[model samples]
Target: MNEYPIEYYQFFIKFNEGDYYTCHDLLEDMWMEDKSNLFLKGLLQMSVAIYHYSYGNVKGTRLMMKVAHEYLQPYRPKQWGLDLESVIAYIEHCISIIPDDIDKVSFSKIEELPALPTLFLYLEDD
Candidate 1:
């Protein structure tokens, strides 16, 4: 199957092409289909994080990045060559430049990554 929705890549292309709102709209559709889909949710959070970062809301951006990290933790996107580490790494890199006086500067760094493990672990119980 295709790795992501047509709209997903379209959003990135639009984002790179400088259409922020369009990106949000695309992700909103995926969000509506399944509120808890980790992939969609994580990407949505990523879009928001980068947007906020660009707008200079360092705190808000960091919060969104943290949420994105939490959302991806369960799946370990690296296994599939997804760019989860780079996402979090970029956010953290930005946060590092923020003065320590910032109130939400609490989360630690992401030092390693590996893709989600096989679900076979649970299947053996059957």
Candidate 2:
């Protein structure tokens, strides 16, 4: 397998562990090093979205999900051993569960919806 940065792999570890905040922090340095890396940006945004969803921040979740989708779309079927298609579909499903009018909804209401699944990132052997 091709080598990757420790942080890159750690991000997925944190994400799968339901530690989205840590996931975001783990990749911040890498994403900062390459501001133009859409993959990193997308993953960061996705982590933030899940973090917000976990806290029932309706508006934040919705906004972050939208941005993550836009940043990740170009990657399409796959990128860096990650399945972008499945990731995007998961984002779309998350967006669908969130109410359109954030003001009309309460955090408690959001808690009633199905919880977002843990996103496991499996690095493919090249």
Candidate 3:
């Protein structure tokens, strides 16, 4: 089996750990190098959307989610060993749960937000 890129592993780890900001940062470098890769851009936008949501930026989250969905649509079911269907469903769920007005969202309100699942890429056993 082929080895996945290091950044991919880092993305999975950071994203699952609820560090969306770091996920965004880690993927940005890769996205910069391959601007034409919609997959990378979608993943990066997804990370940024989550980061925005985590920080109570409703508008930013909404905007990013829309773009992320669009960018990711072409690669359905799977891409780069990722389960795009599951990831897309998760994003949809996020869009549904994110409040229209996040400014007044308190800690308790934040607690109401659904927990995001981690993307598990297929990897070869050592």
lDDT (CA) for every model shown? 0.57, 0.83, 0.77
Question: TM-score of each candidate?
Answer: 0.63, 0.89, 0.80
Estimate, for each residue in 6-77, the C-alpha lDDT of model 2 and write its tens digit: 999998778888889998998788999999999899999999988887767778888999999999999888
Which stretches in model 2 have alpha-carbon errors above 4 Å? 103-110
What ordering of candidates by TM-score runs from best to worst?
2, 3, 1
Ranking by lDDT: 2, 3, 1
The candidate with the higher TM-score, 1 or 2, is 2
Instruction: Choose the strongest candidate by TM-score.
Output: 2
User: What TM-score, to 2 decimals, does candidate 1 have?
Assistant: 0.63
lDDT of 3 by residue, 17-113 (tens): 8788888888888888889989989989998987876655667887898889989999987787787888788788777866666543554566565
Relative to the unseen true structure, what is the C-alpha lDDT of residue 29 in candidate 1, on a scale of 0 to 100?
94
Q: 1 or 2: which has the higher lDDT?
A: 2
Model 3 residue 54 distance off true place after TM-score fit, in angstroms: 1.4
Question: What tens-digit string does per-residue lDDT give for candidate 1 at 26-64?
Answer: 988978988877766776776776565454555776677
Clashing pairs in 1: 79-115
Off by over 4 Å in 1: 1-3, 78-81, 99-126
